[model samples]
Target: MTRRRLFVGLMVVALIVCMSTTLFGAASVRRYAYSASNPGGVWYTMCGGIVKLLQEKLPSNIRVDMIASGGSVLNTRRLASGEADLTMAYSTHLWECWNGEGIMKGRPNDNPRIMFEIYKSDHYFVTLANSGIKSMKDLEGKRVVLGPPGSGSSDNSRFTLRTLGINAIESELAFGDAAQALAEGKVHAMGMSGSPAAGLVEVAATRDIYIIPFTDEELDKIVSAGPFFSKGVMPANTYQGQTKDVPVFMFTVYQVASKNVPADDVYEMMKVCFSPEGKEYLGAVHPYWKTMKNDPELVKALGIPYHPGAERFWREQEQKK
Candidate 1:
């Protein structure tokens, strides 16, 4: 009789376990694709840090599969095609993609939603210190690598130079390759983005470099044309041979997601981004992230609508305040 009672109790427990599994299938691990820029870059570094934090804090159900990709332009395209759930992108790149301009011409990608704005990336005009190319006008008829063919720096350089009436003889080269070209005297100068950007750092290590400064009149001309560019400064000693603050024209960058991401997942993700642990980690990983925090104004730039999930999280935080 005791054996019979034990078997019945065991069966009841088994039945309870099955019922719980059915009710909590959402807890099952889910794999999601995340696209980041080239390995060792600002986007990849920040993406890696955030993904690591999420893996630790999020339920095992949310598994992020990250991929190294071509910077902002390609990342934005992937998000629009539903090929990726998350992407690292620049504000101006997507804005033009949405407006059917530049490389994304006529094929608008207006669907990706901002999860958070990360930092302002600036277009750095690098030349050999003794090159004597002090201004954009000096670039006219000179060899300049304006980022890789489809890169944000490439697009910005083309537009910026065009606006200033400096028609540089342009070449499309990756930042690292461009740096090599500059160091080897193959190119007169190159324009690329990011602070302490790896490519520039590599070149600065071997040769004396100078940052081409944008005069207030030059910056005013650029900013007057659109909201995409702003006047900013790269602090002194930011790079090798950089002795003082350099005036720069800047734009913002962001993490974008499909509007389809579950509201709860995004809410939890934002919490992790702002959590003391996450805040500490990202700032340590990248200099730009030193100022990372939630800001409603970050989303005010040109782009698609904010993720509803992101909106929900913001509302909850506001109430807490």
Candidate 2:
């Protein structure tokens, strides 16, 4: 009877162990990697803010981490390779990568599916106020810094110059260094793309600055180059400047995910990001977030297919209306 009792006790312990494994294993954490641009850029900060929101609002078992990367072009490649679970990239690059055109020629990436439209990145072609470089036409035969190589800003700069038929002596530099070059008169103008970049603000703090505006005819020709380009206006006083409204070409920025990621996780992320609380938190993190809208129409306009999870979220939102 003692031996029988010992066997029964062992069975009971085994049962408990089975139950414990089932209970605890169900809540095991999942980690996802999010890729963004280099540190000190708006994309990196925006990714950090998003990861923080996901941490706060997602189920405790899910965690997201950020990876610093080389802007949009490289981020698209990372998404294609499954090296990044989530990434932020311009709509122009997304279209190019998916279609296997332009810089992404002959190597298509069909894995990236859009999560949402992040914001509009306006082009800022800044020069010293006293430089006498008043227009895009004036940039011809002059030295310019067109962001770092492979960056979205650089691509846009090249596209715009090509479309406008201007041949400027172009060099690639990081945004901060480009701003400093502009201030020190090393470059005639610096073409940057952002919603009033911090580097531009710093340069303006120390020297008189001017943002070269595009004429209506020039804006029309540039936007005609691609469906991704659109007309945008930089409001007066976006930077410390002797100000007036500035017409600029702009492109949409999108948050996309690898198709292999679980649909439910992306759905949950969308819910958290578009929630009133989440938007408020992100807007507080950067003024750019304030420009974000919950509208799925903008995402639909991008011509890229949405992730199944994101599509589900948007469909439900539409049903609620």
Candidate 3:
């Protein structure tokens, strides 16, 4: 009886040792949640590509997961609340969040730090070719879908219309749903931002589309409205039935990290994202990635500070040049 008891006690000790090892191994892997826009949008696709690249390049102990949220405004909130470790937001929105101005007034969130400028998101005002809405002025009484609620695109659309004194009935919808509404004639126009938006491409596939370009005077008013606004051109053939260059007001989209994130991790992420392998992979994922550059001047133009890790990485790049 004594010998049998001894053997059972030894087995119990071994089992506890195995369980402890398993728990420790699981705890050692640090997973970070990255916030981005809803699926079926360019931001969503590009962010997925970035997360995949990070997963492959980052150490096995560090994992990054992408979470789909409303858009820029919500993403910023998430970063400030510690709900997200990284996020994508517009330069205008980031500036407001940092300075406690505009929509972010009285709720300043200074924790967001720029990692890099992702791409130029040009505003697109799309209408069906037969709608007869040839310019921004013509949409005064028309129903317009102004992007999802709390999205940067929505804020931008409202600001542009208000600045130019063009008031239209506005509806907030996701990119895919908005495209469907436009196709069904439920809405007269839709506003979108991003390079070669997937929703616009999908809509153009079935119906002839017209992108209303901003006039020279309108561009001047938009640029004068804020430092974040700039004139941009959408190249000819950017979409089906678009045969000429379309002038548009644009804003920069940036990837930002929380200040709580370790500087070393942010630095490593910048290194992997800017590496030749990373660029090739991202460019293939979307044409927007091709717009990314190593220029620190662009970061400076954001009018906000960079993550220490990102700043360190950029400083090294500057020295190499």
Candidate 4:
């Protein structure tokens, strides 16, 4: 071959190699980004575990990145802006964002969708076991940590407290740090709403304080306000010092994704989250994972409509019925 032809042949081979590399890279890797407000919280831990499981179960090209965020509101906004592929949020806030209610009062997000309900967050107004704080009414004059301003706990705490005619002042702190603050007696009591045996609660309990259970009257007041709030009982043994089921208003925690995420991705994500292996993964991540067993009825309880992909999953399940 002439020198020029040889050079041209080399150039053509280089072009083919470059094109093949680009296609291989695109096909070999799937990138997913996630963020959680309280990285040390149970939800983040469980979600992180799932992400890890995905890495193990998914093709080698799939990569998942977890980012720490400022809880529900921030996560919701991120999802709407297409900054996050998935996030954890409370069902009530999900609705408020969807309908532009409450703290989401002025800004509204209509593009988020529920992938599945994760667990129940039973609101607890806990004081030091020895603090002489017995009920919601008892905390009226005490200094209370309301939880961080935009967190699911903060929203539910304010609503629950208001429902009971108790107007305790709120001190805001990030979720992971709240328990430590409580242990140091920086705040009279901290509001915990979510699953019974969550890591946060475990941290609080290990501090040698008691969990003050809410009264039926207080629980009734919250439920009466809206279906977003419901009665959830925390069995006594859920905590070390507790002995009876503590009745309180509970909120649903859900896994939500942007409206733009593909249906197949959401479907596969849900299946992975609820699978037997997923359950085991959750159990290892946090005791709260024990609360994540798949419940079909939970889809109906979500405050907002399911994502189209989620809806398809439920519809297919229904078709079998």
Local distance difference test, per candidate?
Answer: 0.78, 0.84, 0.87, 0.71
Ranking by lDDT: 3, 2, 1, 4
Off by over 4 Å in 1: 1-27, 301-303
lDDT of 1 by residue, 149-214 (tens): 546677777778888888889888766778888999999998877778777788788899999999
Put down candidate 2 lDDT per residue, 264-292, tens digits, no spaces: 99999999998999989999887787776
Give the alpha carbon lDDT tens digit for every residue of 1-321 in model 4: 699999999999999999999999897676777757564345566667767876676545656678877667677767766788888887777777777776568778776887776777777766677777776778887888766655666767777777777878778787667767766767788876655425456664566556676667766777888557787777766666677777777777777878877777777766666678877887777766667643556656554667777877767767978
Colliding residue pairs in candidate 3: none
* Residues 30-130, model 3: lDDT tens digits: 88899978764678788889999999999888899998887887888788778999988888888888878886788887788988888878986899999
Model 4 gets an lDDT of: 0.71
TM-score: model 2 vs. ground truth: 0.87
TM-scores vs. true structure, each candidate: 0.85, 0.87, 0.94, 0.84
TM-score for candidate 4, please give it: 0.84
Model with the higher TM-score, candidate 2 or 3 = 3
Superposed model 2: Cα runs more than 4 Å off: 1-27, 294-301
Candidate 1 clashing pairs, residues 3+ apart or interchain: none
